[model samples]
Target: LLPGDEEPEVDLGRLLQTVYERAAYDLRVRYEEEPVPPLEPPFAEWAATLLREKGYRRR
Candidate 1:
């Protein structure tokens, strides 16, 4: 409903959910296959903490 007239409708919750799912899926795939140098012991724990904070609790 800006310049051109069309429909007056929007679903913000659905949009946010779609974006979140896409981002989470991409992150999972990229991290699972990528190789990297050894990290300090704390790095693994940090990753777990971040994931949990994002509501990605591992199964």
Candidate 2:
């Protein structure tokens, strides 16, 4: 969903995946000597619910 893109539909899964990947990349850069931590489940559930609500709230 970059600026000026004309697609009317959004791919929510892709969007979330992109966000996770970017976050992981940032962590790797920030902690070059430490391994990136594994994602925890509660946060994942919260993110999914939040994204779902945001994506469908207008309907």
Candidate 3:
């Protein structure tokens, strides 16, 4: 569910499976024996900081 939204019935198992699949695909693209150096602070921390800077508070 989003931060502010109407609640609706959803399949939890399918939702989680979709999220997991997308994350796995993204990870493969990011760390598949890349020649370039990895980001200094890593993706999750960097994303959190960027979102916070943009005034996006976590629920």
Candidate 4:
């Protein structure tokens, strides 16, 4: 789409609601009652690396 082209006005609440619904649906596809694959440590380390690379300081 060309910049400055007219676009439909958005309702932020509706947009956020749709995003939450989509995320929930995606989560259900991979969820399990039993323990699932561990992700916290890896994700945390990855996030830290990203933040550091971006020159963001941790509080």
Best by lDDT: 1
User: Candidates' lDDT values, in order?
Assistant: 0.65, 0.59, 0.62, 0.62
Q: Pull out the clashing pairs in model 2.
A: none
TM-score of 2: 0.30
Q: Give the alpha carbon lDDT tens digit for every residue of 1-59 in model 3.
A: 78898899999999997997978864564332322555556775666566557655351
Q: Clashes in candidate 1: how many? A: 0
lDDT of 4 at 16: 91
RMSD of each: 7.2, 13.3, 12.5, 10.2
Q: Rank the candidates by lDDT, best first.
A: 1, 4, 3, 2
Best by TM-score: 1
lDDT of 2: 0.59
* Model 3: how far residue 9 lies from native, Å: 0.4
Candidate 2 deviant stretches above 4 angstroms: 1-7, 25-59
Report the lDDT of model 2 for residue 1: 78
TM-score for every candidate vs. truth?
Answer: 0.34, 0.30, 0.30, 0.31
lDDT of 1 at 59: 19
Candidate 4 weakest ten by summed lDDT: 29-38
- The TM-score obtained by model 3 is 0.30
